[model samples]
Target: MRLPTLASTVERRLLVNYRVDPPAISRLLPAALRPQLVAGYAVAGICLIRLGNVRPTWAPKAVGLRSENAAHRIAVEWDGPDGIQTGVYIPRRDTGSRLNTWAGGRIFPGEHHIADFQVHETGKELHVSYTTRDDATRVEIAATVDDDLHDSRLFSNLEQVSAFFRRGSAGYSATKTGHHLDGMRLDTRRWQVTACQAQRATSTFFENPDRFPPGAATFDCALLMRDIPARWHSLPAMPVETDVSGSVPSDARM
Candidate 1:
């Protein structure tokens, strides 16, 4: 059957304000992490806090599955000296299922560290709680995910590169399959490196941007990291698993 489009029905609310100062950010991060920062703008960093309710028109029996009725989500974005980072916090129960096979085995494919999240709803507001690493820094994202934004096509191209990187297989290449954005191109490359860490999860790193056709600017280098919840393997066959602890698995290997 045809699944109803929750994309159009999803609603967003602004709960907390996000803030970041470029100078303050520069002073906070280590020198090795600076290259990931986006340049040409003084704004350098951003903070974002959003509260939104989503109602899916249908429901499935698997875990981590999005409900067809309604649910809530809070997402944050931040830019810092190391790189641009974003996190979305979704209360565990809001998701009807716990299996996230849609990740295509790229994430949450096995059992690992997962935690119960708590969210409280009062009138039109929802309260959420989460924790970050002690040494790890947190920055608020200033950018917003546009309601009408549809970049799945672009993301798909990026994912192709991400998949190859995850396997640690060499001699792969990415070419521009298509372009939905002006400055972005679909890239396929060879000799990509897959780096996986216990606490950092898995990522594919590309050393050269010139492998693909020339665009207005070269990406220089690119990396795709997969962020999957730890308890993925324990609860198999579910649509989604919500008990995310914001921590990568302890056993991830390169």
Candidate 2:
């Protein structure tokens, strides 16, 4: 779905990150992309975001839509015209809004699976979960705001972690066609993240033994952002080699 520049309010966004063995990560990415490592481990994660007032740049706030969404992503680097470029490669996207599901890959930049979402947020605590229509993907996370990142093996402080993700604003998503990847860039007016302690977190994709193996991926930390204005801009699709299709799951056919 082609669209003009989109604007939205990031009501809440939670990033649950993991550090995975590079070998495991490589097997999942397409040939055009490779894992972008940090502190030697490949970074992968889930982004659970709730968007408000999502509409075309010129649309009024009242005409906007609100939706709960999630993306299973891996930090990756690829050779671009400029040089080596960094971004996150999204293998799958799920959304609670039927409009989003229908528009995905047509109006939106990526294909989205329809899912039922459950989100409960309080002053300092949060619980988010979702199950896709086909039941192939499920995620559950319970967390609370924290003052700092204390146990992350990937970074020492919050500033370091925030900067790391900020650079990865560009994202490419897998499409069913398998010929090319849809691209999008998230430009936020203010970039801010808070340290969060994940009391419990689980992702079917990251935890799948067939994909990540038992010791291949480990939970690192979580970050939270709220009430930030952001824009989503579409980019030219990146072509993919025919042989790369077999590397991703059948549902995503990257």
Candidate 3:
């Protein structure tokens, strides 16, 4: 049985986002999910987060877990009971915590890979780098946080972009078991963001020729968030509608 909700303290969360070719983004998503478009392109990015005091809401913070984590996510939409739902589809997640890596998907909504991480923060500058132990995935970034949104192209302005993600509280991730996607919702008391300049960034998954041709994905923008309080709740399995256009399997597993 899934817990009602899990509470955690967000020590730090930095999102380094990119605007990729919609078709390219679509290729990466399961058939049950379609890319959530912005100005005709797909949105994808990496999230570097540190969570503290993580445990069931009914539990005490003193017994909570602290961990460093990252996720490769794509903005996506899928069929929903009310209508189409907007959220993120996470293809991969990595963490430095042993428990999360071991019991993910089995006891949690998503499965995690054990990875090493290097992080640094100074004033408004955020730098983070990580790679899976198997070396199959890599993400690195050095960005300077700012309040400018005039340079953004995906959204008309920063507020629009912030609101977009604020509403996308739901996320689907690969489960440890087979191809099943476990749903999870991040409930936060507030939604906030600050634009950033990507001094340098790289994503091997999007760079893979097997996945995307050159120019399919280009770095668009970055966002930063500091300390926040949040809760995570387990959701039911997604209702994916299958189609014949190079779609994912009817019984889609992570």
Best by TM-score: 2
What ordering of candidates by lDDT runs from best to worst?
2, 3, 1
lDDT of 2 at 41: 98
Q: Enumerate residue pairs that collide in model 2.
A: 1-106, 1-107
**Error of model 3, residue 94, in angstroms:** 0.7
Tell me the lDDT of candidate 1.
0.21
lDDT per residue (tens digit) for residues 34-100 in model 2: 9988899999999999999999999999999999999999999999889999999998999999999
lDDT values for all models: 0.21, 0.91, 0.81
User: Which is the winner by TM-score between candidate 1 and candidate 2?
Assistant: 2
At residue 96, give the lDDT of candidate 1: 16
Number of the top-ranking candidate, with lDDT as the measure: 2
Model 3: colliding residue pairs = 179-253, 179-254, 180-253, 180-254
What TM-score would each prediction reach against the true structure?
Answer: 0.24, 0.96, 0.92
TM-score of 3: 0.92
User: Please, what are the lDDT tens digits per residue for candidate 3 over residues 139-223?
Assistant: 8899897867656678887788889888788989865443457789999987778788888989787787877788888888888
Q: Which order, best to worst by TM-score?
A: 2, 3, 1
